[model samples]
Structure formats: structure tokens, C-alpha cells
Target: MLEDLAFPIERLGQAVTDVQLLFEKYKYENGIIFGHAKDGNLHFVISQGFFTKEDIDRFEHFNQDLFDLVLNKYDGALKAEHSTGRAVSAFVEKEWGPAAYRVMKRLKNVIDPANLLNPGIIITEDKQAHVHDLKVMPVVEEEVDKCIECGYCEQSCPSRDLTLTPRRRIVIRRAIKRMEDTGDRAGRKALLKDYRYDGMETGAVDGMCGELPGEH
Candidate 1:
């Protein structure tokens, strides 16, 4: 759970009949599902690669299909959590119905006419908002590959004040990996030399990352 928060997460929560309700259709390969199973609310992480229009369009389609399955078909909530953000804001009206959404828009206009606070937050008026400004994940190692680079993990890190942060560690590792892949031995060696202290040594809060699921 902490690991998911530590990384850049692109996906949203889906509360289903069960997690298997999700598996019954699509094979969520690059993601993992875990949450309060006993209470029927489950959270999963799926790394999205939104590099192109077709890519964003694919995700947009998935989001709509998911909304249809959850909200239209199964009669589930679009957001198990409170705030929807842009990812699910497009569906807010669909979830709450037209009249309720109007009330929400009216309330927002009344309170924040100029829209000073959080421009594209909860209730977005954009028709194709979800298709725009999508976050794309780069090709990294499988260990940190699934990370969306969201930096949620920095807050609870024990070594945050000691040296580098969890996010910083991953970022440096990415550079070092890039150098290695590009055959720049000198650059890679230099990065590893500094990383040996800042990211490698000082970043480990008594082997917190080693506690990942299924790790020995």
C-alpha cells in the first residue's frame, strides 16, 4: 500500500462485486489489486502509458468502459474515494445524473466564480478533459517500472531526512540505468559512485523497500 503511494499512480479505484469481477473480463497484467476485501472496496494500480493520442484514446475508452461496467452495468460507484480528479471527473455527471451535477456546478460557480481554487479538480466542465493531459510512464525496470512517479511514498519514508527520498532514489536510478544502457561506462560509473552513498546507502530505511510483496 505504501509502495503504491510512493510511486506515480495513474489509475483509479474500482469497487466491484469482487476483484474477480474485474478479472472476469480483462487481464490486468501490469497492475495489482489490494484493499479492504471484507468490506467490498478494492484498490488496484495499473500503470498507464499515455504517450500518444491513440494511447490516451485507448485509456479514455477503457475509462468509459470501466464507468459503464461499474456505473451503468453493475450499479457501482465511480469513486470509492471522495475526489475524482480529471481521470474520473469526466464521469461525475454520469455518476450523479444530470440534475445533481448541475447543482454541483451551480454550487461551484457560487463559491468560486472565478475558479481560483483547483482549476481542473473535482467537477471539470471540459467534454474531452480525460483525454487531455494524461501522464505517461517511461520504460524502466520492472522493480520500479510500474511506478507512475506520483511521490506519495515520500511522506512516510523513514530515511526522508537522512539523505535522499524514495522518489529521488528512483529518479537517480533511472538516470544510472539510462547511462548503462547507452554504454556510457564513465557516466554510469560516476552516477553509481554518487548513488552508492546518496541513493543506495542513505535511502534505505532499515531495508524498507526490501519488504515488498513476495520478496525474500
Candidate 2:
């Protein structure tokens, strides 16, 4: 099934090419490199020294270049698993071309013209919209206020049963909460969706996954 849908061998080759390009461009000093080549998705985390403003600009350039090479070159979508949010949505046009992007823009306008639903994400007229200004909900904030950061959740999570860590989920909750406090509704929404939820269930703890009423 995976080989038939979006995770074919060709896609995997493109992902490998993309990662190699990034490594060569950045001279890959120190960073964690991991991802699923079978799915054509990869992630890298460099040291703080590589995160300066100039480096960010360079990174954005690299991102675009890599996107062009991988998506266009391989005829693959820019985003397969992840939703194109504020961070990567700006490149959608480049990946999908003007015609498809226009259709998406029109759909967004019809469904959420007020931009109140989730602004500056997936679609935005303003190219300068910062990552801080696109939050859509506040689930994370509510959760952090409840957690004492005692690390119990980490110790309890069964992800370690598979040699995995659950720390990222906790961090994501806190980060989205901070974004929510800043009044960035679109940003919050983007973060919320990252956790694979439409919205929080009533009376449910922020990070805990619960079925939305009527969803089941």
C-alpha cells in the first residue's frame, strides 16, 4: 500500500537527493538527521550556532531550492504528510503553480474570506506574515497552565516502548500555548492541527486527545 500511494521508490530517491543537497549546502557541522526516505520526508536539527538571522535567510533559500529540485524535479507534491502552514505555505505556489494555487485561493475566499477561520496559513496575501501571527486556537496555553512540567507524562508515555520519545508532544503543546497568548489565532490553529485535532473537546485537558462531540 505504501509503495502504491505516495511512498514509491521514485519519491524516496528524490527525498534522498534533497537531504544530500541540504547537507552539502550547509556543510552539516552538527545536527540530528532523521526522517522516512520511504515517504520522502526528512527532518534536521542543527546547533544554535546555525540559527542566526542570516542563517535563517540562507535556510529559507535552501528550502526553496530544495523544494524546487525535489517537487518539480520528481513531480511530487511539496507536502505529502504535513499540511502546508505558515512556515511552508508561502512556497505552495512555486510547487503547485499559479493555476492550482488560484483555485485554492478562491476556495479559501469563499469558505473563510473573513480570514477569521485561520488566517495567514495555506493562503495569505501578505508575504511578510511572521510565524507568530498565524495562531488559530489556544488549546496549548490551557494545557501548559495545568501541567507542572514535572516530566511525569514523559516517563509514562509508551512511545519509549518503541525506542521513541514523547518530549516533542509536550513541547508542541507549550509552544502553541505561547503563540495563542500572543493573539495569533492562525498560528494557534496551525499548531493545533499539527497535533491531529480539529479542536479541543469541551472540558478536555488541552493536550489530551478526545473525540469532538458528534465526531464519533
Candidate 3:
């Protein structure tokens, strides 16, 4: 929670504690700490001051200590909703424990035998995989390719007047395309869950996008 990080930081300035204790108490401050309270996992943004090798080492130790407090003490996760991607993949085992991690490895091996799909994510060789160099490709070729260069959807978008457009639809199309290309059924299912149907409905005929039965 956002308060969890900030409350501690504010307390530290007033509380009588050594620099080490202060460092230990508020290390999560160096990283962005926010997450869905309903889910119980926090997201973090480590300072870019951690760009150097020495800084990275220090941050890693600091993060390990913070995880020991936040995760082990509180029984929370290092990652809840987000995938064990490039950033937090190395911490999966630390969070999940060896038995659970082995099960995950087995599942990954069964599902992605070749490991060509997002390898080093969620599973990796060294335990110190840092979040770096993650790239995603477009997926929905049919919808994206059907643009016709007219920008009709943009013009017709209900939110366009409010300075917003259906950008998520484009993202969905790309996700669908990736699933089709990589055969990632789980990802496809997750992507499709975000879709909502809009337009008029009539008995035995839905007026979706102004289409009525056989009308062209």
C-alpha cells in the first residue's frame, strides 16, 4: 500500500533510530510502492539512481531485506497480479519458496517446452535476473491490418470528443495477435476478458456497430 511506504518514512524522521534502522525501515521509499489493496501485493519503482553496478548490488541487498520484512513477516507476495517478468522473475523463488517454485518450473516446462515464448520470465537460470530488455510484439494482424487508413473508429469513438479514444482496443488486437502467433491460450483468455459488448440489441438481432441482421 502507498501508505505503508510513506507512513514509515514519515515516522522514521521523528522516531529515534540509527541510520541503519532508518535505512532498514524506509528502504521501500527508494522504490515506488503502490498496489491494489484488494489484491495485497505492492508494485514498486526502484530509483534510477540504481543504474550503476554498485547501486544495483546495494539495492538488491536492500530489496532482499525489505522483502524479508514485507513478504515474510506480513505473508504477502513480491508480485501479485503482474507476471514474474524481467523485473521480478528472480524473486519468485524467494517469495514462493523452493517447493512452489519447482511446481512452477514444471508447469512452465510442460506449457512452453521450447521456452521460445518469453523465456527468462517467471523462470530463469541465475536467480539474479534483473528487470531489463523486455519487449512485446503486436498480435492481432487481421484487425490491425484492417485499419484501411481511414481512422473511422477514431472519428466515431464516443470518447474522442473528451480527448480519449479506444486505444485499449488496439492493445487488445495486438494481444490477440500474439496469442494466435504463440498459441498462448492463457494470455488470450486474459486479454479477451477485458472486452465489453456495446451497441443496440433487438430480439434475434443485435445492432452492433449499426449492423442489423443481414444488412450491409
What TM-score goes with each of the models?
A: 0.62, 0.53, 0.46
State each model's C-alpha RMSD to the native. 8.2, 11.5, 13.3
User: What is the TM-score (0 to 1) of candidate 2?
Assistant: 0.53
Q: Rank the candidates by lDDT, best first.
A: 1, 2, 3
Candidate 2: list runs displaced more than 4 Å: 1-8, 31-33, 36-51, 128-216
TM-score of decoy 3: 0.46
Instruction: Give me the overall lDDT of model 3.
Output: 0.51
Judged by TM-score relative to the true structure, which candidate is superior, 1 or 2?
Answer: 1
Predicted candidate 1: what Cα RMSD to the true structure? 8.2
User: Which one wins by lDDT: 2 or 3?
Assistant: 2
Pairwise TM-score winner, candidates 2 and 3: 2
Residue range with the least summed lDDT across 10 consecutive positions in model 1: 1-10
Best by TM-score: 1
